[model samples]
Target: MSQIPPPRRRRALGCGIAATAVALVGIVPTAIVFVLASAMDPNYGWLLFITLPIAVFFGSVALVLGVIGIAFALTDRGGYAWPIVGIALGAAQLIPAAALLTG
Candidate 1:
């Protein structure tokens, strides 16, 4: 049997972890929004609740991709920093979204 290359293994692992993190980004914000909406104002809060999940999902993808890209870069592979920057911006948006939904 041919042994797999080390670099390929690292990339695969990094990609998997990054993907999982990206997926989780949606769940966290959505759960937060849902709970807050349910408690404070389930009726109209429902409408405003839409943005949180979408933002989290995309934002998380950016963040995870950034971190993974950085790691890959450090290992000699190149990647753009857009995902990292995107995550930072998205993080800022989360605060306001939470405030609107809860407070």
Candidate 2:
């Protein structure tokens, strides 16, 4: 018989999933906006100022959530797959945001 995961494990998994979704929600739109902005005239560059800050906010939230999810999973002996995925996605979002912010 398969045993059900504990509540903590389930919560951790949910957190991981949420983190990944948040990261994607931030990254994808910002990427599209950046691409469009780049293709357009320099006058549209102001769009980056708006989009980049939003992306950074979401990325930061995702990173924190992913870290929290990972910690919960580790402590509860929950499976690590989702949390790792969350961390990867969160990192992916952050990298571009960092580059945009610094560049």
Candidate 3:
């Protein structure tokens, strides 16, 4: 019998996965900072300096990646699931950045 062909590879899939992972990774420090900021005094505000940059950087990159992934998805270059998740999560990741500035 003839062998079956391998599955087709999707474009932008890596971007979607990377965006989701970046967003998730950014959340840890953001959560930590949020919890600490809530529990402690402004004296601990110094911690924001450490995590804020990381959060912003990750969040921004994830948002960009998510957008690119969605573009590819729309063009039928890739599947839609991961890109949607990436967009949602990446937007959520930005909340900590906003909080960092406001708090």
For every candidate in turn, the CA RMSD to the true structure comes to 7.8, 3.7, 3.4
Q: State the lDDT of candidate 1 residue by residue for 1-103, as single tens digits.
A: 9987765335534554565456456556666766778887776466545756586556656566656655665675544344345455546555665677797
Per-candidate Cα lDDT values, in order, are 0.58, 0.78, 0.80
What are the TM-scores, per candidate, against the unseen true structure? Answer: 0.40, 0.73, 0.70
Per-residue alpha-carbon lDDT of candidate 2 for residues 28-91, written as tens digits (9 for 90 to 100):
8777776776786657767767777777788788888888888888888887777678778777
Among residues 3 or more apart in sequence or in different chains, the pairs in candidate 3 whose N, CA or C atoms overlap within 3 Å are none
TM-score-based ranking: 2, 3, 1
Cα lDDT of model 3 by residue, 23-79, tens digit: 888778868877877897656668877877787788888889999988987786568
Worst 10 residues of 3 by lDDT: 40-49
Clashing residue pairs in candidate 2 (N, C-alpha, C atoms within 3 angstroms)? none
The lDDT ranking, best first, is: 3, 2, 1
Best by lDDT: 3
- Which is better, 1 or 2, measured by TM-score? 2
lDDT of 3: 0.80
Candidate 3 TM-score over all chains jointly: 0.70
Best by TM-score: 2
